[model samples]
Target: MDTMRDRFAPVVSRLLDEDPRVAVVLAEIGKDGFAEAMRRHPERVINVGIREQLLVGAAAGLALTGLRPIVHTFASFLVERPFEQVKLDFGHQNTGAVLVSAAASFDWPAGGYTHMAPGDVALLDTLDGWTVHVPGHPDEAETLLRRAVAAGDDKVYVRLSVQANRQGRAVDGERFLTVREGRSGVVVAVGPVLDAVLAATEGLDLTVLYATTVRPFDTAGLRRAVQGADTDVVLVEPYLTGTSTAAVSEALAEVPHRVLGLGVGRRELRRYGTVEEHVAAHGLDARSLRERIGGFVGAGRASVRA
Candidate 1:
């Protein structure tokens, strides 16, 4: 099975072939994968060298011309580095572009803090009118990418990560899927963390809700899952901890509930290690998650910061 980034290039290549209105902009980060795409559609496939600002600015310029631009780069460079452009060029201008990001969180541990982007989703949350997609498997990534490209002049961000689940769920880029139905509590697994969440909550009577498109926050689905059930909710994401806790709170504002946000934490791990090592260090592995989730649900009041 290919990684999400591994599948992005060819998928966009096919999209370029199918849609004349679609365009791609890069900043020399993943240009090698699009060699064939560049050769085939030199005019549409753009590589703006190392200028992250130029990458987004160019894509916005393309969008101004009524073309749906798809921009790709590392999360740090794509969202953090050129955030001003993302705010102004896309958001302020009322122009929509599909911003696809790779290397979510600490996917590439050796790349150091500069390459990691655990705060990308949180930062984008400050802005309005942005649809965020975090796909756990390549199939889900492909589905979200296709939907983003097909979307007409809408600001969409599709987050791609190296970490993935063992299998892909049927994701429609809309609502959350109910993996398990229970009355104890609800665990919302976003992107790649479904398998670990499943392992952690094994034997526990809890509703495991899976999500691909997280920005919309599937309020109705979550309400239905917790209706007459345990009002306790837990969000296990692959990005910064508590990224979606606010959304969850707003979703259940009318009801009395408690939410525990779990994901990459604010503490920085300077040492460069393997991905698995980072997962363990951040307490995101199955063992740590099981302990934290069990404590939270059992005790009825516990704060587990990822």
Candidate 2:
């Protein structure tokens, strides 16, 4: 599978070379991937060392100067650590930027709690008018990034995870794409969690929906899909659990529905080794998802064994 960062590097290089108004701000990360690109367009690329706050601030400044800025860094540093900068510098000032984040959730669990950012999406939800894209595959990432860059002055958050699904590209719209069809219920898989969700629901009578563009969420699409189904929706996100609960609730307000939010558990497990271990610890593995989802739709246990 092609890595998201690897896919991003070339697109950014192309953007820099083609558009003089495009600038990239990095914070001691992605230097290896963007080494040549940076060297080629030294004036357009800026690295602010380890200072995430200054990194975002500089990006905001660049945006103010009529240049589109793509701010790249780990999810922890880009969204969590320098949240104030993101909220005030960009959100408050109304400056637009493509906030590209890598190492989503517990991708680098060995890096510990400080490096994990399960709350990044929830935090971004607090700010208004931010388009959040959680691409499930590298191809989807490329498509989303290109669209975000083309939609200049729109504050977009492109969340990239190390994990990927079984290669599926998203459609050219802000709507959920139906991957599998069934009458039991609807399973909405966000970003890289598609493969896991697919495995979990294998052989089950359920509908699976995929979304790369999460924010500006496809509420209309969701409502249309759930129109004649069981109205049992299970949202599987890669970030904080229940991140889209409110949106789902609003979308299906008039219909009688039962929704189960699944993602990295709310509690900090505080123990980690491999990515799979962290995912299991958070009850995000295929088995756990199957059981929990089964319970939600009345196919298994009375309650999920989390």
Candidate number with greatest lDDT: 1
Give candidates' CA RMSD values in order: 2.7, 2.8
Which residue segments of model 1 deviate by more than 4 Å? Answer: 301-306
Alpha-carbon runs more than 4 Å astray in model 2: 299-306
lDDT of 2: 0.89
For candidate 2, lDDT tens digit of each residue in 89-147? 99899889999999999888888998899999999999999999999888888888888
lDDT of 1 by residue, 10-69 (tens): 999999999999999999989998899899999999999999999999999999999999
Per-candidate Cα lDDT values, in order, are 0.93, 0.89
TM-score of each model, in listed order: 0.97, 0.95
Per TM-score, the best of the predicted structures is 1
TM-score of 2: 0.95
lDDT of 2 at 265: 80
Clashing pairs in 2: none
Instruction: For candidate 2, give the lDDT of residue 193.
Output: 88
